[model samples]
Target: MERVGLYPGTFDPVTMGHLDIIGRGMKLVDRLIIGVAVSEAKRPLFLLEERIEMMKEECGKLEGPGRAKVEVLPFDTLLMHFAESVGANVIVRGLRAVSDFEYEFQMTAMNEALNREIETVFLMADVRHQAVASRLVKEIARFGGDITSFVTPTVKERLLEKYRK
Candidate 1:
């Protein structure tokens, strides 16, 4: 049985921290599906298409031999439903702090109740990226602070472009 994993997030800008989780998540599954959430509630800076394109561009750099095949898609339904729809054996999540764990823990419990077949795996963010979050990244960029360290050049350019408009 091929092991497919789902990593679901809004990915408003697809930061380096997100890429870190994705790159590491690939090692644990045969295929990785990056489910970009259509989180209208978050009022994302980038449109759904723009977010998908950014994820594709950054994820393209991670593709190569010995790594899981990566696919990016948009989803706006229950997470477990999306995972099942994609035939995922696990749902990968990133943990950067205790607060993240608290929220994820509740989510995992709810998801487990919904469907115990798919497990949730949490990957700790790299120390350098532990403090990085899409919301914070946008704030820094909005104030003209350097965000080159939080995201890739392509993402940084896209983010700046958004603010310029």
Candidate 2:
């Protein structure tokens, strides 16, 4: 039985913190699936396809543990459904602050209720990258603040282009 992990998020613009979690999570699973959620409520800066492409580009650069494959997939349904479809036994989530806990905790509990076989694992963001988030990046970029440090070069370029239009 392979230990596959599912990491789901509405990565409007994949940040360093996200990559950090992905890198660490990949070490613990035989396969890691980065699930890009089509969250209409979030009003993400990047479209689903753009977000998927950005994540794919970044994930492609990662080299995980032996025989550990990384895949970027798009999902619009419940997370548990996505996890089961991907054969994931674990769900990976990143926590940057205490405020994020309540929501994540609730979600984890709900996921457990949905599928007791799947476990949710949380990773604390690296201290230096703790403040990086897609929403904040978009807000800053909207006002022309320096976001080069928050996102990848590809993402930064896309943000700039989007804002410039």
Candidate 3:
């Protein structure tokens, strides 16, 4: 049976770390859906449409023998519902540090409770990207700091434009 994986995130701007996780996760699944969260819980620098487009453009560049069917979709409802809707039995996530573990553990436990069939898989961020994060990147960019190293070119340009304006 073909395995479909769900990688959900706010992805206010897709970071190199996010791409790293996606690339590694693709090899483990037949299809990988990049679910962009449209939650109002956190203020975002880029609009939902822009983020989705950015993710699509970045994910589009992944091509190889281990490439999975990549799709970027927006979701506002429950993550479990979104995963089920996309027919994803595996949920992919990235761990940047031990600070992220507590929250991720809680989320994974809750998600498993909500749907036993859905499994959460964790991938550690690459050493080079260990300190990269969307919030931190945004804070740096908002203060006129260069973020070219943190995100993809598309995302970097968008961040610069957004912060400049």
Q: Could you list the CA RMSD of all candidates, in the order they appear?
A: 0.5, 1.2, 0.9
Name the better of 1 and 2 by lDDT.
1
lDDT by residue for model 1 over 51-130, one digit each (tens)? 99999889999988889999999999999999999999899999999999999999999999999999999999999999
Runs in model 1 lying further than 4 Å from the true structure:
none
**lDDT scores for all predictions?**
0.96, 0.91, 0.92
TM-score of each: 0.99, 0.96, 0.97
Off by over 4 Å in 2: 64-67
Q: In angstroms, give how far residue 160 of model 2 lies from its true place.
A: 0.8
Count of backbone collisions in candidate 3: 0
